[model samples]
Target: MSAPRLTLPSPAKLNLMLHILGRREDGYHELQTIFQFLDYGDEITFAVRDDGVIRLHTEFAGVPHDSNLIVRAAKQLQEQSACPLGIDIWIEKVLPMGGGIGGGSSNAATTLLGLNHLWQLGWNEDRLAALGLSLGADVPVFVRGHAAFAEGVGEKLTPVDPEEPWYLVLVPQVSVSTAEIFSDPLLTRDTPPIKVRPVPKGNGRNDCLPVVARRYPDVRNALNLLGKFTEAKLTGTGSCVFGGFPSKAEADKVSALLTETLTGFVAKGSNISMLHRKLQSLL
Candidate 1:
């Protein structure tokens, strides 16, 4: 008998330390970040079908039916393949929008990974990752399903075994536009790029903090509060910040403290992606 259809978790990511080293002539910022997969994120369920019609069951609130990343990914896959296949894409969005958490990118990555198997398309990891890179720099990490140190507009990923564990992530009530942050005249674009090396221990910093703090006071305040617990740092651009703790209980303690202070939020610890791990189990 054929294996059961797969339901995957497209995990969110925290920029443990995001640094803007410089800008390329192509207008993309060269950056460095320790990317960690979160325990919670968006979920996408897929089922193979005989008829070659793609359908989306979600309205996705503000996003259009046709323009959703899942659909876009599906079309990207179907256009390249000789096989005829259909899928039912259902997305349960747990990650916040405009939070620099790569929610949409993860969804797109999951779609690409799922359809490759469901439709029986023969593309391997490198091919899927290459396709994912064209979609977005962040998409490739989700395609690979592991934590890493990333560079080059956040595309170059080196699999990191990161003293990997629980990290207390805090998403502030305010949403920061990544484009706006990158576009700001005050953004430092020449901090000197660092080659991928050992994942630096906790003291690593995000260069965008000063720029983000000056414009978004709420983020600064959140960082201040989290600092009381551990050496807190801003993730990606701003709006969401995180601090590392040794244990889940400690992480939860910090999260509880945030509950009384900031309002809009997502507080969770680090985790490995289960999407393809489950696939491995079935295989």
Candidate 2:
């Protein structure tokens, strides 16, 4: 095992609220969203090599090796940084794909960050984050190591510290296609814009929830189920629903029952993102 035994985490995110404001000249939606990092997520490990090879090992069967975001992210980093080492990336994926949780984007962000250190490229957070934005809108937030309020195609970020930590009853189920949700003409694109100001000290709304539930029964069911336990809301577009609890024990109890009823995970919310603190620890 001569390769650098590097391990990294790609944490899942929750959109505390999603507000769709309008459409852009680029055909992208203008929006506002509050991003929160989860305690539960996926892990990845990679060792450096000079063979110019990128490899990914996972339980996820049938994904094309070249198409895997982790591999592609590593290659992109290597190419742009002109690093001399190749990477063998290993992803221990736990987050649901296509759930609007930003799992894949987080994976890509982790790849970009982990390889920078393993390859000893010494790029700063801002540089890596800029590169990450090129990969995906969500990637930049993860790379910046913050749970943020995002706008302007989601690259613009302003980190906010939630007044208190939260408990999340996150539904894990069939992945939903973001493209489908975004392309739906029925999707809300005309919600009035609200200026971001410290999250208004309370729960906000997900503008896409109604549209998503109509198309995905799982989400509708989950929403109904979760609403009884706590005020649950849909995160991002679809496939995952979340409820906020005031206490961890209460959330855990619900999570245990939810685990039996539905396949999902319960996690704590943090004011500080694990990815940022994780990297800071290394230095």
Candidate 3:
């Protein structure tokens, strides 16, 4: 008989605010950021295999199977748990690559959480998140599946319930490399950390914006266009720019106007990731 299949949502996230506090000797930046999920993102499906043979049926044109976060996460969990089981993975890609929306990281987290359930590993969130940190700084937030305030290379997380607003997100035609943005000499490395609980309204900003805007014309154009409608902000080191609206109707109006010039979409922001909600329902 065929193995049971489980499909799950892999939600995207926005860095509501990102501040670079300093650079570490380890070459990772010391960051202070707020992370919140979007109602929209990619979807993943998994089928278990008794034999140890990890595989991803979906193909991402430029990303190799070995390098894909889904594969890496699955492998990490398998090794850590010494599980004899493997998985057949498939993804329905929707989130734009290199958009700073945490697409890859979210996928990795979903795989770890999903596999843990399927394989019956029963790892706690803290343990899974620690394993996720080895994959990427953004992975833990997705693993924890909550909106949070992050510091110290983006692994230190403190949950926060920020306003759940509707956002009009514009996707630029070009891809912005996070590495290129961080390595640039012009990028700001020191923004005094905010020391307030729940982070006061509009208390933070992305320091990478100045450098990102100067380097990617498509990103700059999208930002300029959206800024005309609302306070457009760059999420993380972005190729995507977004602005929040008080309602879905308001966000849709802005998205309609901008879609004429750029590719974009509208989604409701959430303090709790959709992935966690689904997992909870299953339990």
Candidate 4:
């Protein structure tokens, strides 16, 4: 008999809008953003081990085993919860690294939730999300599995229901370094915060776009090509640009046209993450 195993979707997220209000004393930017999930992403599988040794069987090039976010997340949860069991983790890598699409953070969150379930730790979402935040700023949104209005270095989340639209997302060949983008003197760090509940429509702008577009020609080219079909906007400190369409057919049509010159995909925007939906089905 084999040890129990579970596989979960590690979904990607888009920062629908990102506003950098100021730089904090700690050098972290004060950001206000909306995070919405996409139906498409990587998948992660976990098998339990009673001997209590956390391990990731899948190797990511350039990211060592212990340093991988999935491994770190599993180790963190095991230590924090004082859970005796360990996990063997594997990932079907699909999402591009450093694409500004919350791939790593989502994988970390999935590890936390998966181990929590398989280990029978019975930890609540709040506790899990708090642990996840120490891993990355975007992890809490994945843990909570909802579209959110996020503030305070992307930790403070207020659930929001944004209209789910089909998205055509283009992947630029180059990976944009988020640290480089944030540290650029040309980057906008002073967008005024939105005070009202349910942010207004015209606020769908990412503050990092200008700086990112200037530094990465691939990103700039993607934006220019995708912009021809719809209102293309960068997500977070992006190497990925996305535009919303009313229907999957419309989004797919544009994806087919643009993928000739660049790589891209079409997926429906989701308020509730697919990971949570799968977890719920087991209940």
Candidate 5:
């Protein structure tokens, strides 16, 4: 008989605000960011295998099997925990790659949580998040499944309930290379850290905007178009730009107008991830 399978939502994250404090001696930048989940994202399905071989049935062009975060995450979990079970993984991808939407990192976190459940490893969130940090800076937030105030290369998390708004996100038809953005000599790396708790409103600025806009005209154009409707901002080192509205209808209305010129979607922002909500329902 085929093994029982579990499918979970791998929700995308918006870096609501990203500030680079300074560059560390180790070549990693110290960052302060707020992460919030969108109600929309890709979906991943997993099934256990008796053979100790991790395999991902879904293939991404140019991303090798071992290099894909889903496969790497599975292997990392299996190796770390010394679990004998393996998993067959598949994904229905909707999130754009290199759009600054955290698709790959989200996939990795989903793999970790899914395998942990199926294998009955019983690892806690802290342990899972620690392992996830090794995979990517953004992975721990997805693993923790919360909107957070993240610091220290995006691993240190402080749970904060930010106002959930409806967001219209525009996907520019170009990929933004994060490494390129960070390495650019003109990039801002000196934003002062926020010392107060509950970051003030109007703190949604992303320091990478000027550099990203200068590098990618598509991103600059998207920001310009969306800015007419609301306070449009770039999320992370983005090729995707977003603006929030008071309601879904309002967001959709703007999305309709903007998407006529550029591709985009409307999604409600959530402090709690849709992935965790689904996981809770199963209990």
Candidate 6:
């Protein structure tokens, strides 16, 4: 009999507030940021293979099969668990690449969690998160599936319950390169860290904004346009800019006005990821 396919949501995340603490000698920056999920994102489906041949049937433009994070994540889990099983993976790509929405990282996390459950490896969350960290700094938060305050290259996470607001996220017509932003000479590398609990009010700012806005007019125009309605901020090193509203109606109302000239979407912010919600349903 063919193995039953398991499909799950791979939610996108926003860095609601991003602060750069400092840079390490290894060329990594220490950061403090708050993460929250969007109810909207891509979907991934997995089918287990007994003969141990792993494959990703979906094609991501400009991303090689070996270099794809989803494939790497699945291979990592299969190798580390010493499991004689593999998976056929497919993703419905909804989130834009290099949009600063954690698209690739979320897909990797979903693969790790999905494979662990499907293959019956019985690995713990901490072990899985550690494996995820090897993929990217953002992967662990997605693996943990919590809205959190993240620090220390974004590996150290403290769960926090921030307001779940509806967001109008505008997609600028250009892709922003994270490496380019981080390497810019004018980028800020020092913002003092704050208390772990009770994040200060009016703290939603991204340090990468200045460099990104200066480099990409599309991002700047989107930010400027959105700022007319509410406080707009960039998430991570962004090609997408967002502003939060009190309700879905308010968010959609604004999105309708701006989208005539720019591409965008409205989604309710989520403290608990859809991935974890789906996992709980399986219990």
User: CA lDDT, every prediction?
Assistant: 0.79, 0.80, 0.93, 0.92, 0.92, 0.93
RMSD of each: 2.3, 1.7, 0.9, 0.8, 0.9, 0.8
Full-model lDDT, candidate 3: 0.93
Please, what are the lDDT tens digits per residue for candidate 6 over residues 1-283?
Answer: 9886899999999999999989998999999999999999999999998899899999888899989999999999989889998799988988999999999999999999999999988899999999999999999999999999999999999998898999999989788988899999999987888887777686557899999999999999999999999999999999989999999999999999999999999998999999999998997
Summarize candidate 1's per-residue lDDT along 11-124 as a digit string, tens digits.
878887777888889988888887877777788888776687788888878889888888888888888775687887777887877777888888988899888877777799
The candidate with the higher TM-score, 1 or 4, is 4
Model 4 lDDT per residue over 8-101, tens place: 9999999899999999999999999999999999999999999999889888999988999999999889898898898888899999999999
Count of residue pairs whose backbone atoms collide, per candidate: 0, 1, 0, 0, 0, 0
> In angstroms, how far off is 252's CA in candidate 5?
0.9
**Cα-based TM-score, every candidate:** 0.91, 0.94, 0.98, 0.98, 0.98, 0.98
Candidate 5 off by > 4 Å: none
CA error at residue 82 for candidate 3, angstroms: 0.6
What candidate 6 gets wrong by more than 4 Å, as runs, is: none
lDDT of 3 at 115: 96
Clashing pairs in 3: none
- Model 2 misses residue 81 by how many Å? 1.1
lDDT of 2 by residue, 122-182 (tens): 8988888888888888998888877788898788999877644555555656777777888
Judge candidate 2 at residue 260 and give its lDDT. Answer: 75
